[model samples]
Target: MIKGIYVHIPFCHQICSYCDFNKFYFHNQPVDAYLDRLDQEMEHWSRKTDLSEVHTVFLGGGTPTSLSLRQLSKLFDSLEQHFPIHQITEFTSEANPDELTYDKMELMAARGVNRFSIGVQTFDARLLKVLGRTHTEQHVERVIQHANDLKFPSISMDLMYGLPNQTMDHWKDALHRAFQMPITHISAYSLIVEPKTIFYNLMSKGKLPLPAQDLERDMYDYLLTSTKKHDFEQYEISNFAKNGLYSKHNSIYWKNEEYLGLGAGAHGYVDGIRYSNHGPLKKYMSALEEGNLPIIHQNFVTEKEAMEEELFLGLRMNKGVSFSDFKRKYGNDLREIYQSQLSKQIQLGNLEERDGRLQLTYQGRFIGNDVFSEFLL
Candidate 1:
């Protein structure tokens, strides 16, 4: 069943150096037209599938907060028309601190948006500029204060480590400032300069100076220890939550569950097929205008591929993958499928079995990508 819906808002007031997501500058674009097409797309899908099972709705970006109040209302109206908005258990919208004003937040709250995922990469002003972020420390604090005042059910912040010229003190300061806020969740990630991003170009020219591997590992270590001290539970490798305020939307991806991905450049898995929509605005809108679904690529997921994905994605969470669940889903004993790979990782002290579930060891998480790759058939 498709239990989650991801709506992408690919507009940003300012582009960050490290971000490679599909986004256009908010100014002078056909914003209203795009929203209309999005509505049409939703209408098309609503007729084909039962969206009542979608308990989680996530509005991610470029920056969802970049939309004007009227535009947001229009988007929300379309959502309510197609999906059971009132029945959604968790509704999250990603916002940039500076762009998300008090009024915008209020509009979201009135429309049933219960969670805010604010981009607060670092607290240091210098690093903020380096990351091409327009927000200051004041902007982040104000947004958090506004969310608190609105009594939003959950407030999450995104932080980055392993930044250019970023020292241990810089990371510590960012974490210190983060903990000072009354936020419920923190997602700290190490930077990976993907191709086509500004950071990638700079790195190609040797202009980017990233932290050493060991230092980056140490930074992650500090993050785990500090978040634990602050009474946060590490639900996933990079996600920490307080008061059980886990991000239900993201949990769907980690569990390899089916979800509806709407908007240009969005990807979805439904009815055993993985698919992606057209990335370009023109291609996406033109398809919808012609009464098409805008799907550009798709593949039927084989049972072998599904089982491989089950291991690599499920192992990211703290609870890991259950042996019984695997058997129920695939009708194959977990030990029999990948016995040699499992044995090798267990012998290397990188994986362990507890309570009939397979999970990554402490050492495995640091080299998680390496461990996950071994499970690939």
Candidate 2:
């Protein structure tokens, strides 16, 4: 059952240096036409699949709030018309601090949007500029304040560490300011300069001055300690939340559950297959216009691949992977399948078996990518 729906709005007012997501500048783009095509795509999907009441509806970006008030209204109107929302417990939209205005916040609240995932990046003005983020620290403060005032059910912010010239004190300041807000969730990530991003180009030319691996690890340590001290549970490696405030939409992905990925550049898993839509705007819109699903690539997940994914994705959570659940799902014991890998990881102090679940140890969280790689068949 596809219980979650992710709608991507790939339009941004300004591009971030570290971002590599498929998006175009909001100025002078065919914004209304894109939304119309999105509506048509959703309608076509509904007719094909028995999709009605989803548990979560997430409108992520480039920046969903970049749309005009009228355009936002039209987008939601299409959503409500095609997709039922009364049963959606968590309806989220990602917004940038500068563009997420008071009026837009009000519109979201009125439209049953319960969660706002704002991109704060960092509180340091210099770092913000280096990251090519246009929002100021003041803008973040004001946007978060407005969201709090409106009493949005969940207010989550994205923060990044391990930037150029960023120190422990710099990280501490960002974390300190984050906890000061009346927010429920915080997702902190180490900056990775992916290929094709501005940061990547600068790094290639020796112009980027990112922190060392050890310093980045130290920053992650501080993040864990500080968030825990503030009574937030580290539900996943990078996600911390107050009691019962876990992001339901994100959890759907971590649990490897089925979801519908709508819009260009979106990836989704349904039944036993994983699929991605076309990333380019022209390819996406043209497919939809020609009464096609716009799916550029898809693969049926083999049982072996599914089990491998189960370990990697499930281990991202603090609870790790359940031994019994794995056995039940695959009709085979996990230990029997990867005994050598499990024994090696445990011997190396990177993993442990506790409470009938195989999970990453505290040490393993720091080198999570390496730990997850061991599970690959």
Candidate 3:
């Protein structure tokens, strides 16, 4: 049974320069139609499987808060009707600082949305402009303050480092300012310029000047140290939480559990197959209108692939991969399948077996991509 649901809202008020997610400008789009199709897609899922009360539901975007107050209400109502909201321990929605108003916050609270993940990329004005973000530092403060006033149980914000013209001092100042907020979670990520983004185009033209590898590493180290000092525990590589407020929805992905993915450009894993829906808006809506799912691709995982996924995905968490759990699930010892790779990583001082789990050491965290790559068989 799927324990989680991820709904993709592909509409954004403004596009950020570095973002390459599946999104479109909110203006002049068929917003209501898209929401209707999303609802239909959920209904489609109910037809295929016994829709159980999901543990968590996350509405990620193109800025889900970009919708008008009425639209947001309709969207939430539709979701509650399709997915059992009463059983959800966590219901998170991504919001932009500028667009997240008090009315929207009240609506969210009334509808049982307990968590808010606001996009506050950087507190610096210059860096914000460079990233194509329109919100100022004041907007972030205001939105977070309002969310706190509403008594939302878990508040999280996203920050980015390793950007063009970003420095250690800028990063430090941002971190200092973030700790002042009433947020319970922080997700700090290093910038990666992907294809089809403004940053990628600028780099091709010799216009972008991102920080060096060593400086980026310093920023990451500072992030870990600072969050730890602030009484926040690092749960995942990019995620840190105060108290025990780990993002349950995201944990599902890292734990390699099944989830239902709804809306355009969403991907899902159910049974043993991983599937993705049509990315284009028109195609996604038209498919639902014709009473068919917009699934464009589906891959049935072989045992070998499943085991490989178990390593890379599980290793993403600080708790690491469980040896006994792996053996119990696969009916084979983990060390026996990749003895050479495990020994090599251990010998290199990058991996350690502790508390009946195999996890990355401090050195391995720095070169995590390389360590994860070695697990591919």
TM, every model:
0.99, 0.98, 0.99
Candidate 1: tens digits of C-alpha lDDT, residues 253-351: 999999999999999999999999998899999999999999999999999999999999999999999999999999999999999999999999999
Ten contiguous residues minimizing lDDT sum, candidate 2: 45-54
Alpha carbon lDDT of each predicted model: 0.95, 0.92, 0.92
How does residue 320 of candidate 3 score in lDDT?
A: 97
Candidate 2 TM-score, C-alpha based: 0.98
- In TM-score terms, candidate 3 sits at 0.99
lDDT of 2 by residue, 96-134 (tens): 999999999999999999999999989888999998889
Best by lDDT: 1
RMSD in Å for all candidates: 0.6, 0.9, 0.8
**Looking at candidate 3, what is the lDDT of residue 23?**
95
What is the descending TM-score order? 1, 3, 2
